[model samples]
Target: MEHYHDRRLVEQTWGSSNAYTGSNYTDYPYFPTLAKQLLPNLRCVQVVEWAPMSDNVYNDGWDLKLKTPDGDGAATAAVASSQLADTSLDCMFVYFDAVDLAGHSSGFSPQNPSYMQALENVDVHVGTVLNALYARPNYANENWLILVITDHGGIGTGHGGITYEERHIWWIGSGSAVAKQQITGPDPGTYNLLGTGIFNQSGVDQAKLKQSPVQADIAVTALHHLIYETGINPETYPFWVGLDGKSWLSQFSGVDKDMERNNIKVFPNPTTGIVTAWFENPTNDHVTATMLDVSGKVVAQHNECSSTNKITLDVSGQPKGMYVLQIKIGEQLLTRKVELK
Candidate 1:
């Protein structure tokens, strides 16, 4: 589905005040606003603190007050469950802060009873949301990718410093599209020496350390799944470029193979002038082809494509550099990389 609706619900709780109610919450590059503009079908439902309803279709006023972690989680779960049941809702981001509040109020350690209890409570809320997702009437026909992640880990009663406990965090991605393998890095050899209160990685291999996923991967992964499934390249709209993280799904067995099987063949990739693309299967939909520079600026385009399996574009006059060629046949978008030498 090229056009899909998205929802974002963040619970009002401790440690998330800045993100939910701070002055900069509605500032530029604010994700909810940017997403709404980019994805026309987006519908955001924010349960934040004191924020008025957004002017557009972005927010449905659900502003709430500070409450216990469990309470906030329950509220978020209810919103998520309700939104998930709506067939028009394609993607949803639900945030629960009870565990973080517990960690901040008490010590962030296994021995801390409050922290452990908070984790248990959040787990139940997660189950509730997942159950709602699976119970959707179109569940069997939908390809949903569920990702759970935290911003940071804590040390003792607080966090913020670049210690091992404060930096290392967990990420879980589940769904039919997700890989079955675990993503891990080489042991940093800090487990036994954690009691020493030292968090440096002097002897650790930086290359291996880079193997672990970072925070940026979450957005890229979500975008990759959306683009692959919907067959719409957001980059065609001249955005989603210059991303920091690589999609982890590409490393495992999944959509890449499926795409290759139905791949569009483009020859003379390092062409001096004209480039031709052949669709493996015939399509009756109207076709539009566009070529964009590495900076996402459209340089050339062709819109007179007929009901044929092949289309060609001429970029011989453009500067010698790499460019992306996007072919939109009805709602299915196919992309090819071209180089002018």
Candidate 2:
């Protein structure tokens, strides 16, 4: 289990082993750490490692017991309920591994009674957490985005292989921000092989077996809702360009017009100093570019009356952080995020 955390840290950091050394997961830039840095007022909590043999500690700000009790799932639920009651808590990550344990002990198929029972137990625990969330005193005014996801699936009694069952998993998100629609994967032709074998079998175009949602999108969706609810500019954080997925909420609605049309292209996004924006076509209209900090205050501005298709914003003098870039040309307006390292 501890190795699992290490491997995940390595993967998230783009295979940078130097970022995670000697069982220290805090060295990596995790989403929770970034969230706390972005919003000091926001309280992030993590409850993980329900397995008995697991170390049960991955990163800082974890507020649960180190040892799992006999009924670990129920214990996790109790902690989740208690944490959700805290008004200061802005985000909480709870992990329950009873189903995984059951699958490993018995079998990873629906035909296994023990695995099914473990799933049912976890479902009850999830229900308890949801009940506690709804019981919040300020639930009426608060907006929450609840996401449930799994790292991987299993085949027979074990996983970790490149089998289709081990790769194919599901994600469930429910909240005010999430659209009330089910997103499923494209059908892998021939229903006969669906239940009997892996979906990515020979003769099936693996490229066409794409899905509407991805696991990486989970982080982006959470960040999007957090920014929207807190009224913080997305550019305030330097990790947007490094995000591996797009927000699911942005897929159905709230699309940025400037980004949708791709009329302007920003290169070297995570730049150290200078950033360039190339327009699709040259504009004769007067162009004005304003650079704003995290507080929405203008830190720098550029004005160009000459006809050109490119604009450059220099933030070499500014501190290392994220800044918003707004460009106005005639009646057309465009916005971009700039990262200064």
Q: Report the number of the highest-lDDT candidate.
A: 2
Tens-digit per-residue lDDT, 1-341, candidate 1: 01111211111101122233322332213333334433445444443212232322233212222222245377778777877787876566666777777888897888999999888987998899999999999999888888788766677877655467765667888888677988776644322222322223354444653477655456556655554644543333334453334466665545453242346888788989899888843658788888877645788888854587788899998999888788877777777778889
Question: Estimated TM-score per prediction?
Answer: 0.63, 0.63
Q: What TM-score number comes out for model 2?
A: 0.63
Scanning candidate 2 in windows of ten residues, the lowest lDDT window is 190-199
- Native-vs-model 2 lDDT? 0.62
- Model 1 spans > 4 angstroms off: 1-39, 42-72, 186-210, 230-238, 257-325, 329-332, 336-341
Question: What lDDT score is found at residue 290 in candidate 2?
Answer: 78
Residue-pair clashes per prediction, in order, are: 0, 0
- Clashing residue pairs in candidate 1 are none
What are the lDDT scores of the predictions, listed in order? Answer: 0.60, 0.62
